[model samples]
Target: MGRQRPPRLPPRKMTGSLPTVILAGCGYGAIDALRALKGQARVIAINPYPYIVNSGMSTRLLSGRFSLDLVRIPLLEHIHTNGAEYVQGRVTQIQPEVQTLTVQTELGRRRLAYDYLLVNVGRELRTIAGIHHAFTIRPAEQLLAAQTWIRDCWRRAAQGDPTPGLLTFVVAGGGCTGTELMGELYDLCQEMSATTGIPLTQARWVLINRNRYLATGIAVEKEGQNNRFSRCIETGIRRLGVEIWAECQVKAFGPEQVWLEDGRELLAQTRLWAGGLQVPQWLSECGLPVGPEGSLIVDECLRVKGSERILAMGDCADFAWGSQTRRLPKIGVYAVRQGPIAAQNLLRLIRGQPLIPYRPQATAFVCVTVGNRIAVAKKGWFIWRGYWATVLKNLFDWLYMRNLKPVRWREFFY
Candidate 1:
């Protein structure tokens, strides 16, 4: 006897008579927007994960100073406490014409309708050939996996494994993430060497960057066609016994080999990629106008072009300043600054009032932490590097996390 399959259930509608405002991603900007629109509208926050990871402190987590619990903010609890609904699912499709969203959840596929939508899903790591075999810096959770891999390598070295590359680590990309990661990895290796009675020289670390300079994102000053900031950072990193390969690109990654564009191959058991980022394909597929990098094109008021009901911020949004073709850098600080503006604009949109434009700062401040409690900071033509700079960076990160969750003072230290 053949049994009939279970009947397919209809899509569950997730709205009432009240106007709903959907927060597409629970990122920095979305969190602030949720707080602003708490009592003004029926706010619903949707994300695949139940928590949001703090990327600023991700390297601290990798270096074993911060715990996983400390870096993750309880998004579900925060939303429910603020009188908003939380949906644990991935937004598969967005039908702007119908004001409907297709979400894939555990129960089944559900269709949600909203009067307004705010997107800040953030960007995903750009992939290269054989990227699957290497660790990436997006999603923030992969840093934990890399931490575990490092511990395993230390364990093998402690047991006198004669295999080469067991203690070798390679980081591709010299951007903020890759440089910070390399610094933390250097500190981690030093700690492991001290604990395992292995000489630190036995551990190898290499940082590869396609650009001619490291930390290219930082504000640069040209002194006879030379970037002063990059030169300073390069000297600091080299002093830490780490190798820096400039003007190099990683072609592919294997189990223990990294192939370079110049036909050079390097063997390393642990490989990490933090090269670049791109928006999710589904964002462009949803019929919204996107820029070159697949980010939604937002106007001066943070509203999507040609749509009043849609707004976007963060790395998922492409916003250009007045009369400028260059878009703002994809950084958390800019997203934080855009949150309140997005929320206020949403309120004004609902009340049929005039929307305010978001003015991004011309010169943004940036700080990159090196190992041994040292950091480099730059803004416009000013540059600073020292322990005090590290202190300032830590203070900023601590305040940011403390605002999101109740964090203990001890969590910031090892």
Candidate 2:
């Protein structure tokens, strides 16, 4: 058998006839660009996840309201619609001079050559020691994991196994995500304990953040000072029987407790970290100009600094306007708006036309939900809270998903 070994097969090679445009990541920005580039060239979309999860609806996933399928859009469906190739892999390296990308696939490593590249790998959650003790409301997997954990804890509670901290849920970070998570979780616990003999009142929910004031809520930061909006959010959280610990830093997460910097310990059966988001390390380590947060530094025109063939948008991009000291907020709207501009600029580049600069909208609106049918909207100094705010938030989310999942399946065989 050893002497009768067969000949090895040769590596497959790509024909050099088509110009390739590689869109890395299936985030809001990347998807938009992929749609725009349809029929223009041979597009290759690469993403590690098989589905594109809508972050806006992630909170609802924790509750029993939305199923995983409701929030996930298949990446392959989009690729098929645009007549593009979809590679389920992560980008390992980007060689600018050679215009090639090193991708790590399930089978093995593969090389992709591209005439243009759009990097929108997005950001990852910040973490601390014993982070495994906590759940993060990030991509679909994290949200699903947290959902499972919550259900398991509730089941344990129903079985009279409510150990110390087993019924207590602690949410670290007072940012928009953290605040909303605590609110949504409060509702979930209430629902789970409604008829299970485990009264919701027995369940404890806590929020800890180092920031004296939350960035977005009923209150807006005025001139770097905490104002009434902060109090409003605190009042809402308190009304839900949730405790708030401002200016408190999380030192370490124990198996069943959270240790604070001030030597205080909290019993948390389930801990959720909505602390903050940081750009992926690969962005900075790949020899590109990156900000302190590891996000790619992009110019006004949404082009990556020091390169015209490369561009970055969304949470992965650090873009500033007139004020170089402050960067644009990493929100969905900014990325949505940047998509068209990036597509236009890219098309212009291909046509040897001048690129258009992007001007960020000054006053961005942010809506943070506290509970079902209750939310807060902040726009500059204007702050509003009511059912209408929640409705508006849902509307925005719906509009975004509607634009993303387009049905354009005009196939053309190569």
Candidate 3:
């Protein structure tokens, strides 16, 4: 993909000036919106973190293949270069009726008023009892912590005291996160075994899924197409000596074992969760039109159903589209695409022009890396796996970051 500058956005030239367009969340979607409407509107971005973690490359972070500083870029620099203000605060409450936001900052709580609002705060992890006992990849910090723990485990195994479960790395979830995690773990363990002389048998890699196969609910077609993709991933993982436990539900977590719903216990100390994502609890409490997952309900134009001035995007939004009003999936790919669309629609409304409806592509592309320079990608009926797939994944990751990089960073790279 070639580098193309975003359309320059100068403030709308109307009879009177408008209030600032406040975008909450500094994820891919929010940043894209900020890029499009940077100079066009008085834009302010509110996010708890100071950096935007490139989750596309986060899987490599697990295996110590990539560093955090490389994947996570400072949002302040990006916002400043794009001619926008970055608010280092978390939005505690949103009052759409008064168009005021209660933000929690270092100087205590402050109320911010905005003419238009964009909610892309995204989802929170669906936690369970003893979830703290497991490692998660949502926050970039968690990945750093996991890296330390994994290295320590490898060292311990080298000393002949490969603690139970510590060597048996278990990833719970069959989705993209789980699949990528398994691949990275496979390579990590294999490299550690070869370097430290730890037997591969001593180090266990397991993937537990409630469903019978992996990538269960993606754009996979029926008539065993899902199984075909599942088999492809299964082959890739198993070839790397990974164990797959299907149709099994994790009941609870323990320090040294994972209890199963079927009265079975898996001996493993390390558990990585990549399943069950839910929107923030505050979204539903704020009296907005939220869906079952606590995501704000948005119309085809990506506008919040009840309030025209307020819009929602990314994983934080439950969008209804087309005649059937089908709900879209919560994927980073969609979030990146929706950013400019939402920005355009907002600009159209500001200019008194008709808002265009967002129509998602019928087939969503998805890929999972399978250790040792291999990956599996699915686009409609076509499925590719091997070295070429891995090359595609790397190119895609570079393009994703390249498109979202700040002006200064883009200058340094390009």
Candidate 4:
């Protein structure tokens, strides 16, 4: 089947005298841009509270490590550390014709203009209705709701309740977040069992993906990485004794059960959509040049088409992926790398200098954690595993966050 391209967008004017850079979406990508432009422009960063409902960090949070609040990657705090403005609200509209943005905050409807704009609104999983029991957190409020439900589950488990209830979890995507959630949940159940004595096997752990083989088309040496992830799910379920139904497509949901297309109906408590993210509807509604994924079409220098004054970085921008491909993943790494390049380009454009073409790197820094214990590294032909890989993964996660927004090095040692 041919790929369904994004609708064509009408062009806008290229003139503006605004003294602001409206950086939207405070996820990993947006934060990078915010950090880079700390004192250059009056930046306004927007985002929901560090996200909790995406099910990306379910295991770490559900393990009772101070709940989901502690797990959130706060957008405001990260930016404030580098001296920037933050608006905690939803961006309801963007009007590029006048180079203005409308936001709905607690204070009420507010408007702002931009000299340069970088949209980094991360992505949201596709959530279905009538699946309230399996609530997924995308926004800040949803994470609070999910956390409340978890507390209730813990209460019931502690009471030795054996009733089949609607507190089960089924992750419906097997990408990085899905795999990590499944493995982490397995560990959570084990840890919870020791605390509540409810038998870890009582909780169900399901990876409901459409893919036949896990991580298909993954590199050969990285087979160990893929297998380690698959085995983490398999051995995790075996040792913890949980249930998993792979290659199942969810058709609909009942009050206490979820229906699969293969004539299987499983009693489920919650159905997490780890499947994928779509572009924000508002962007398309703006009639700008957006790619199929709702990513703004930009040149090598990350300038939005038709408007040399406008630029987008991170998830919202559709820049080339690597040295070969013309599309990139919506990963934090891309945003982090692009932040410096985008800033350099924007600065050059501001100073009336030659714009540098963004050269996407050939190799990516990948550290896929199968579960909490193990992770595998892959870059070009390099693939290695075991405790060393996990160590490297931790170091990478730490250094990635630190290097992007450098913190006091003494803190790490102290």
Candidate 5:
């Protein structure tokens, strides 16, 4: 025998021969990986939930048609809350050699040991020059709160004393999140007027896209992209009464407003910064090797460099797919995919077998809800436009959530 390989370790409980597995982050990445682990190892999770709002969907949630809760997967509903141990804390530091993490929780500072460690902690973004800030929705409750504000704004506009900025809801990114958000709110504006009796003129869903054209990535056909951009215009970007500004970068921020690259300035009391996302600072702080974008550079096995005991996935990880270099686009699909891989690799480690590498998909699709019961579906060489696309998109969102971490755990067990 090759020096007698160690036996596959069993999952450690409070007291056991197996070591603990400390998984940070409760996002789709963290929670997904943990759920796939089954009984391979002990697990612990940390996240500041019932807090943070991404605001991408905030405006839509605020409008009261959909609840913010629709966006988040509660950790307790999936993780440690059932039987595993969970610390309502954030991991401030990770030491690989000793395999321990330093965390600050409601109780206080504590160091916990682990046999295997995972860093799924998602990234953070700042708005309004990093002062007086709001966050993306971390829990479902945040959506309900957003609903209240939308109602209040409706009240002001309905009373004929509409605040100058009350009519404006500026979303600043062009990513799928921002794209869907702006488009959703635009639809809500139409619904609010028709249903709540509030005039469509009272609510504005302004999308500030830095790209010269919206859907920059999905615009596969150079002419088709231009045609789609034209369609957005003809599709009532202006006729729907929502303001659309492209290639407008933020020059400066003010307490109550944002100055744009264009000479013409926009002043809105409600400023939402959806201007894309930078990777988290903590990955660098934890002393792991990071790529240019602040994401962790992982080997083919999804293992962080210079450490065999640690792994990364989702938004924080950069893996080589096939081409020059790529991270898995930091989407729900990739995170969900990484979950099973991470779990399998953990088992391989426990069994002293070859670790399996994660493979990327051949293509992906984006389903965006456009106003008037219409949606736009963009995939490689394919575009499904109209109400049917919106219906498909809504159905997809429902089914995806339903199967992955569905409302009922019994389904998973069975």
Candidate 6:
């Protein structure tokens, strides 16, 4: 099938007297907020792309199991159908003092005024030296290119082109994204080996992590002690014939080498980096109260610190979990939970009603896909893995995208 194109939205005539709620970025939280604000306020969503890519299924897209069309939700059609305006542009500047935004669009720069603003720009992939030569798992579009590159490598290897590192794939991190990617890459290589009649032993797969264990930052506790989720993940990936290099850091990437911080190098033609993530630098310079990692500090009501008319969530906002001042993890589950609350609070703020404080769930479900029809899931201290876990992950993804559809279709399908 051909790649899907986002529909071009015509210039909307601003005729409504309703208060305008501008969503800085149409991420998971912002999209949910947009749905709640429908018909209540004039909503304008500003995003660089006319569609939102679901990052949860991104590895599947890279493995060629999911297509671009399946992972991307076209924003123009849904926003317009829900009584909102969509602006395809990058937010250049935020003049909070004047309650306005300067967006750089295809035509030119445009100044947009709003009564309330919701910032959910999200985070970008962290980069290292010579990162331009390696594939970073972000922008969602880049995964398509990586997929094409893998196919080309397979073709060359099948024809006995004798290219160095032709079947070697190196993943430069053992975080969730990196782990999933390594598993999928291994699966792809094995499939290719079977199809091209090449020996599977000829291919090499490596995962490099700076931490002592895989998924170091993830919270997996059981009875006041850490659980075995990380250990399980490490064992699972290793069983797939992947070399795990713990406590290792990548210094840079050369033409066909992954340079290590310890002065060692690994030769691999295809390199994938999933080191870390960081908020946009522009966010810190926007004069907003920012916390760690330059994420905007948000209060209990999901409002930006000291700003009544501005709210932030998702990876772009540093939201405290409780009185202890621990920030919530930058994940889709938190954003999904915060979306409706943020929208409701925005409406209450406008109506002079008592706003509700957002209290995060005590324990959230976390799941990571390792390979085709294989996954690991955790909730509190309980852990599950294998095909059943993968099923649960797919169900979650399906429900998220299904809810993004118009109400009419949702009701009909139900």
**lDDT tens per residue, model 1, 1-414:** 112222222322445455789998877877777778878888989998989887777867667767788888888877887799989988878899999898889999889998889987887778899998788886676878888889889989899887789999999999888998988888888888888888988888999999998878543234422277777778778878989999999999997899999999999999989887778889999888999888999887888877768899998998875443557778887888999999998777666667778888766768887777788877767778888887788778788888888988666643
Q: Write model 6 residue lDDT over 1-414, tens digit each, in one string.
A: 112222222333355577888989888866667667888888999999988888877877677777777777778877887789989998877889999998999999999999889998888888899999898898777777887788788889999888889899999998888888887787777778788888888888899999887876555234232337887788788878889999999999998999999999898999998998888888888899999689999877788877778899889988875445666778778888988888887777656566677877887778777765578888887888888887777777787887775322222121
Which residue pairs overlap in candidate 6's backbone? none
* TM-score of candidate 4 relative to the true fold: 0.77
Backbone clashes, each candidate: 0, 2, 5, 7, 9, 0
Clashing pairs in 3: 9-40, 10-40, 11-40, 165-268, 165-269
Off by over 4 Å in 4: 1-18, 29-32, 35-39, 50-59, 65-83, 140-160, 165-168, 198-203, 215-244, 321-326, 403-414
lDDT of each: 0.82, 0.75, 0.77, 0.60, 0.61, 0.80
What's the lDDT of the predicted structure labeled candidate 2?
0.75
1-414, model 4: which lDDT tens digit per residue? 112322233333345532577876665456556666766667777775533122333344433432444334555566778687877787777788898888888889888887667666656666665555465535434545554565567568688666575347676666666665565555555555676667654566667766654433333234555566455444433343445555767776776677778888877665665565666778777767988777788776777777757777766787754444447766656666787777666555545566666666666656554554655566665555455765665555456545543444333220
Model 6 per-residue lDDT at 397: 78
In terms of lDDT, the poorest run of 10 residues in model 5 is: 405-414
TM-score of each: 0.91, 0.87, 0.89, 0.77, 0.81, 0.90
- In model 1, which range of ten residues has the least summed lDDT? 1-10
Q: With candidate 6 superimposed using the best TM-score fit, by how many Å does residue 333's alpha carbon deviate from the native?
A: 0.8
Candidates 5 and 6: which is better by TM-score?
6
Task: Provide the lowest-lDDT 10-residue window in model 4.
Answer: 1-10
Which sequence of candidate numbers ranks them by TM-score, best first? 1, 6, 3, 2, 5, 4
Candidate that beats the other on TM-score, 1 or 2, i.e. the better one: 1
Task: Give Cα distance to truth, residue 14, candidate 4, Å.
Answer: 16
Prediction 1 TM-score vs. true: 0.91
Clashing pairs in 1: none
| Best-matching candidate per lDDT | 1
Over the stretch 221-313, how does candidate 3's per-residue lDDT look in tens digits? 453776788789889989988888888888888777788889998888778887667777888878789887788988777888788678888
Model 3 spans > 4 angstroms off = 1-17, 220-224, 406-414
- Which parts of model 6 are misplaced by more than 4 Å? 1-16, 220-227, 406-414
Q: Cα RMSD (Å) per model?
A: 8.8, 10.4, 5.3, 6.0, 5.8, 7.8
